[model samples]
Target: MPSLREDGAHLGSAQEPAARRGQLRLAALQEKVMLRFLIKKGTRMGLLILFAFMGFLHASIPDSGADDMEDISRFMENAGRIGRNIEIPENLHKAQGQKEAGKLLEYYQSEAFKRKYEAEIERLKGTVFKDTIDSYYGDSNGAEKDSVKGGTLPGNERIYLFISSSVPIGTLRNYARDLDRLGDPNVFMVLQGFVGGMKRVKPTMDFVRKIITEDADCDIQKNKCSAYKVKVKIDPLLFRKYGITRVPAAVYVPDVRIMDVTLSEGMEGNAKTGDHYVLHGDASLAYMLETLRRPSGRRSIDLLIEALKGGIYHEVNKR
Candidate 1:
């Protein structure tokens, strides 16, 4: 009857530990195992801390010879793989050009490289010789005849070479050649034959005048290469006055003397052997521009020579 019915059971009654010795022993064993696990974990943490400290100390100090050797070995091994056993290839250098190579070493040593490059360029320029109406006199052979016609000349100066007619294509071509050799951007070959003389002449003359006034900043972008053209009548006065006793006669003029001197002075200067600022019909356009830019009485003959040589034209009447 007691088993079949739901009788009052001792649910609150406690089972004493001393009575269950096996269970208590098992519990004690589990606690000991947990303690051992925690101790092992602490020991592992201590070893990790010790390793980290040693690594930091090693890195802070200078590397030992052994360390350097290891690094060198690694670099050499990699370099060998890349085919860089000795010095780098000639092309594959910090400075590809001689100029750059010079900079890589002593800065002063680069001067030789500069000189060599310039010398080579000069040699090439010599190869590119020009034959103009004027350059015929540059020679020693028939130079006297050409010189006789070419007046006193300077190394580099803008000269206005007045031609009566722009008709003869050959003569115009020769004149162009002269301009090429002169390396002057400033040149005025006055062509007298064009119709609407003032209409054409005014624009060209005005354009050239602007160049003489403005210097390098002349309206080049505007198709106004007017630094190089002038106008005049097709007469013997233009010839005899400029010593165009022969075709292609050139006259030289100083930047300052264009207004005062007669055109004959220009002609004489072309042939004579002496130092002069203006070449045959050459003028100091750069000098005038500089003078205007910075007022100075000091003559910039050489500088002007450079500008003329650099190719700036100066016209005759536009003086």
Candidate 2:
């Protein structure tokens, strides 16, 4: 397995250049949008509009420096089918959902995703500062004492909420909380990349942190927010696996509870896995759940809904 390890300090240092490049890219995009608008209006000043755009584009998108995370692309595999259906390899499936989510989260958080940051995170766990930060930001959606109230993932259905930066912050926040409430590592909120680009991982990290912390407006570094309970992941592979072409969509994978694609050990030889049912829209989780349940008579769907209702959502779990 590729090591999901990296130096946390290097992650901090690369922010300057990446932000500069991001600003340039944003400016260029704005100029292009303005150019298209002005030309469509038929002001008979196409030449002048083009001239203005050229200046803005030159200033905005700039010829460019480079990104700190650019190195990751060299190591990163593009998202696409592996050209073969690989089945679950073994009991190694124990490393299933949570491992994938946590590893991807660390991949985005660490330097170049080559160095592991768990040691640092674990080291911080016992600090007074970390304690204060966790309490203020929220350590869980409704969990107490680092204890999640649930049994095994509880069903054969795997849920995924595919989203992007374009989705409204409030919508993302609600989804994060709901998934956290479900308390299954198998359930996830997957973003394709940061708003501007994936050349840097900080933006994705910061945005997801905000989404899970329930502090959309809080400037993460300057302000205190709720503890982040969920670990939003970026997995283009899963995105491709689900055939996601837009934001605010969801996928329901039924059956094969023990055989998620994220499992790495034994999927190399298998040919069949769960079927994928996708729902496209910007709706509440409950709405999506109901819509997905409709038209499908699979028992797994109901079992999935029951699992959602269990865990922290139980009568006492809710209280």
Candidate 3:
């Protein structure tokens, strides 16, 4: 038997891919509609005036002389027809637009369309928006994450390089290079809080990426976000503990002993830490380390100084 299908049979139903594309279009349109709705009130009157002016320009209407009482009477008689003329065409267009809209609504709500797009929304969310959600909320909002944790740190001797976004790029670059050279596990670049404000997390993360990478132009997507050799972290509690106000400041805290203690009555055990040697300046890590060195010299501080003694520094530490 010969085939009875029409020549346009393939066009009768859209393919799976076409349906998915249509769903995306529908989603895009919905987002636009929502944005319009938000600003609709301000746009309505302005658009009406704009529409009237554009209509006059499009018509190329000639300037007519002012009408007399008789001419006004004539126009008043014709005004009813003018209103009727406008009403009929508007109603007709509304009917036609509504009919077409109904058909589109039906297609979008249909089982086939729903089946194509329903799973896709979640799939897109999981793949594309996974990091967005993690980097922005709950445990990952930067406020709750790792106030004390900066990769792995030594249990005893520690060096905290207090820094902020306001610090000069040159100063930051110096710190970056020297910290990499030092390569000490106890060293960390500490920030008191977010750069701009804690209201959003992107700015802070962006600042961190900008300072850490050697390349000025770094994009995460292109994999240019090079990881720092040293750990950079935000620790507000640590800032409070050490009373850090200004930067660039380095605090050498050594002889910290970590131990577990039993519970006390309505009291938390204080952190077991060593004496802190503080130095403040806009100098390199090696210089700061040298300046913060003890008069008699402890073994841990001596080791840190030895690590940076060989590195070249532009500015000397001591006055």
For each candidate, give its TM-score against the true structure.
0.21, 0.48, 0.46
Question: How do all the candidates rank in terms of TM-score, highest first?
Answer: 2, 3, 1
Determine which window of 10 residues in candidate 2 has minimal summed lDDT.
1-10
Model 3 misplaced regions, further than 4 Å: 1-154, 218-225, 259-270, 309-319
Best-first order by lDDT = 3, 2, 1
lDDT of 3 by residue, 1-319 (tens): 2222332122223444777657756766677787788799668978989999999897896656566767988888899888777743436588789898788546543676445533543443354334432232214223212333432333456678889988998788677767765656467688877677544456775676566666666555454343445556666656777777898888877654434321111122445675777888888776676677755276666666666664434225432
What's the CA error at residue 117 for candidate 1, in Å? 52
Q: How accurate is candidate 3 locally (lDDT)?
A: 0.60
C-alpha root-mean-square deviation, candidate 3: 37.4
Comparing 2 with 3 on TM-score, the higher-scoring candidate is 2
The TM-score of predicted model 1 comes to: 0.21
For model 3, which pairs clash? Answer: none
lDDT of each: 0.41, 0.59, 0.60
Among these predicted structures, which one has the highest lDDT? 3
